[model samples]
Target: MSERRYMISGGGTGGHIYPAIAIAEELKGRHPEAEFLFVGAKDKMEMTKVPEAGFEIEGLWISGIQRKLSLSNLMFPFKLMSSMLKARTLLKRFKPNVVVGTGGYASGPLLKMASILKIPTLIQEQNAYAGITNKWLAEEAQSICVAYEGMEQFFPKEKVVFTGNPIRKDLLEVRSKREAGLKHFQLDSNKKTVLIVGGSLGSQRINELIAGQLSWFEAENLQVLWQCGKLYYDRYAALETESVKVLKFISNMDLAYAVADVIISRAGAGAVSELSLVGKPVLFIPSPNVAEDHQTKNAKSIEDKEAAVMLREKDLDDKFEPVFKNLIQDIELQKKLSKNILTLAKPLATKAIADEVERLENAVR
Candidate 1:
């Protein structure tokens, strides 16, 4: 007999794509016989990333509808229609037992098609503020797995399961790897190391603030591991002195997190969850340009609990340097933030969601 199969969908940003990939990884690990296929936007980051992660993917013509009236809005009908047809064709041929969606442009059409085809469907919501795509698909989804509670405003209370966000397993199990990780990164045992990440595309405000403070960090006898993103690396590459290490990206984030005394990052949902699991004091610089100011909501959720700090983009220039420096110097404060944030960590998120997938599959069979 053929193995059971699944079709997972989500994309556009790493925030959505990475979590979907993590869920897929967990599912595959639990059922090695399960065959997994992915569906994402045709020209999205997922088209490349999903395949790179060793899964087959089919791209839809769909893209997110813009808020303001634009040329993209006019093309929406065509994109949606084409995507529906493409997704239906894939479903008709593969006959998956279940379809899982982590919210992004592609997930709506893919999951909607799965529901219409009488296949069990699920949605994983990653943000504190829900996205419209998931909100639209919620009525049809068998279960809407959520990272934040009180989402009954968008999804059915019965359908909502607060399973936390599925992060890379490496981030969860690194507690014992600290010394080895510090050594692997060539970080000093005695000096404090602050890990700064600005997402993959990079955050302009964050890079600017950190770049402006390079000399100060060195003066304090601090070491830095900076992921400046690909866009801003050239400008900051000159800051790579004896006390600083700057790279366009850090593929080994587990090791990076293991060595960090403090973390400076954008308050995306994925970063928040990872920071929580890493149990590090974090200062969040929420980007102003994102949808519905969701980053601010994400950062504030943790800040409300005194688990992390929030630094807005507009205030970052005058505010970040002092805040960053103060947090680095305050060992007791760092311990407090780390302890509090660890209180929010859900290390079993992957397993929790994977078990839900298994239960849903069994009921359908």
Candidate 2:
């Protein structure tokens, strides 16, 4: 495959963007001379993140349609057409050997155009529940790489490959970093530590719940490492004390995982995958604002396997304390959860998905 030119599309959220970058990095490692281009929605997080990851990205004039009637929905047709035209232009110029979509608004148009042009395409569905964009591209996509089983309900069974979601390569070393993590976060090694994360932008409901429970946690002799997110940093910064370390973001997530005895987090696909590898007892509080209630579905999948416990956002007031107490206090339950969750870890997912991409590239050649 002549230098292996490639195109990858996925963004808007870290769940989508990180997997795209992981796949790109793996492919680049295998084929150092390969060329890569990323497609993302204009004015979205991908435009910034893709570039930072050392990949060139082109932005589409696109956004997801609002479920409720709004001004943005009216321009959907125009944005879709404009994005399609732009994608056609990019594909023609780039002449990629294989195009990959990780499920985002921009990916929908780019993959659709690539399919129509008879270009080989792959769609990576990170969630157990398929997103709208992936479902739309499934028929024409040459391969559908997914993190969960039973995705055949959304994509063609013949094309589906359960390769799993690619997570940060550093996360694999978490087990060896526990001491370093405790020092990094300045938390006590003897006390139980609970880490809370509410996705990239942060979940207001989660922050509120945690804030209300800070005294309760203190009484329980727990130390907290909280990533409240950028949006809520200002609001919750005052809560930081020796026992409660609050930050807007956790850059060294490997360390965060290492220091955590138990984790309370949103059940985004990326979070779920990373937590699985961390192998800690986790209490998933899935966000309700997401599309199709996917966070809940993701949490349920692990909960069904006894790998993690889940609490609905609406049930937080009544269920959070009791469930969390049981998880931390019960040593047997903690061990079981950690063991079961580790069983679901896919540390080599990046390479596996890259292998799939290369297989398609070779098939076409």
| Model 1: CA > 4 A from native | 67-69
**Residue 88 lDDT in model 1?**
94
lDDT of 1 at 274: 88
Cand. 1 Cα-lDDT: 0.87
User: TM-score of the candidate numbered 1?
Assistant: 0.95
Candidate lDDT (C-alpha), each: 0.87, 0.92
Best by TM-score: 2
Tens-place lDDT per residue, model 2, 293-337, is 999999999999999999998899998888999998999999999
Clashing pairs in 2: none
Cα lDDT tens digits for candidate 1, 1-365? 24689999988877888888999999888788889889999887899889988999998988887889999999999999999989999999989988999878899889999999999998998889988888889999898888887889878899999999999987877767879867777778888888999876688888888888888888889898999987798989988876688888787888889888888999888888888999989999888788889999999999999999888887876787788778988889888999999999888887888888888899988
lDDT of 2 at 168: 81
